[model samples]
Target: MDPVTGSVAPRKILIACIGNIFFGDDGFGVEVARQLMIRRYPSHVQVVDFGIRGMDLAYTLLEDFDELVLVDTVSWGRPPGTLYLIEPDLELIAQAGERGVFLDAHSLDPVKILSFARSLGAAPIHTSLVGCEPESLGSEEDEISVGLSPTVQAMIPAAIAMLDKLVAELSFAKKVEVTSKGAT
Candidate 1:
């Protein structure tokens, strides 16, 4: 426990980086994970690059964690490289039905993964996504691209900043929860 805050010192945080490195800007999440690995985070924080492994991510969700942060490339029809921080709506997930089906092995579908996890048992109470808009998912020749485009590459720092802010907010919320529990 933290004496100053009267709360637990660390809350388990799972940062799941989801994407396919072979698909140009779709590799954004993988790159973010690579960059974050170079830095240090609290011991309770587990950062992993799932990299198109939807099933693996679903299984990881079974582990106890206070929060889950998903980083990926999202197509929201904005400019290429636009960053977004979204708290996925559980209501929508619930409405989407519970089925653990994937059309492709390389598909990085968070909604499907979450549904599968929920079906298994419990999922993290808190979840957020740091997403980037992609300019191109592959090469002009319709072949797989190995790296991100220039615009997407430039947004990495911005995405990292967003992730940092989200982490701080989750930490504060955890402290508040502990303080309230102690008071009661």
Candidate 2:
């Protein structure tokens, strides 16, 4: 906060995109990160693509950021291409250390990463997640399907729109829950 005005400083946001392109629609985050990188965003907003690198992302999470937004493919029994925003319960996540802070070299586990960061004494960050329903993900060891399904690919623009809105709100010190509802 500013000492003179007693006003809070604008929050810095880290948009961490995680995915493995070989897992089909699981590559949503990677693709989204690529698209976001081509556009212009505020200096306070950092967009990163840590595809299948759990440890790299975890260390990045330890940085002092006011807001963290994780973008990935989330399956919540919703129709394919459905975009939803989820504000994770950080307290619950911290307590459920039952999952442990194990990092797999092949996948990105946000929960474990966050827990591990907290265990490392990093301060709690206000985290929000933006996920798209996947149409198909190659989860088989023998399967190496690449790229995103048509449905999930279509939602990239909506995801970018959501982040743009979020960045704007962060500057104003407001919290918002968004859906891909009006996004073209």
Candidate 3:
């Protein structure tokens, strides 16, 4: 028996972390997603640590998902260890635009992935981002940057808290939407 055929579709939620783990702060997404998976999130939440694959993100989004959260280290002109939340600003994003960036360790850039998602109509209406100041982009030792340092690691708890809240909001919202649709 195909269990999935009879089962209710999992209410989809995708949390994607995109970065190069070898490049210090650039690895924030992979690390955070890794830690997050250790927890018991709702059955619907699917977390993926996309390491440095940006262009491929579009394919992932093609899956049925009510909510999607993308995680990456972003430079907001802030000093290292600083963390920032990127509000869903499609215009701001399109304006900022995208270009290919090569990592000594990996492939693809976040902007390119987002751009692809946008073009494909695969984007979730409620999208958000967490950006961390990158202290180191390249180094042989493969150490977390001094700029990101110990202080920055402290931010992970807060970021996780933020993720929890967002998930709850989307979960509740989806429920309400589904209920409303069934009623009509």
Q: How close is candidate 1 to the true structure, as a TM-score?
A: 0.86
After superposing candidate 3 on the true structure, give the runs of residues whose Cα lies further than 4 Å from its correct spot. Answer: 1-11, 92-105, 118-124, 139-148, 174-184
Q: What TM-score do all the candidates reach, one by one?
A: 0.86, 0.87, 0.70
User: How many clashes (backbone N, Cα, C below 3 Å) per candidate?
Assistant: 0, 0, 0
Residue-level lDDT of model 3, residues 28-79, one tens digit each, is 7777888898998877898888887765676787777766688778877788
Residue 11 displacement (Å), model 2: 0.8
Clashing pairs in 1: none
Better of 1 and 2 by TM-score: 2
The residue pairs in collision within model 2 are none
What local lDDT score does residue 111 receive in model 3, on the 0 to 100 scale?
50
* Superposition TM-score, candidate 3 onto the true structure: 0.70
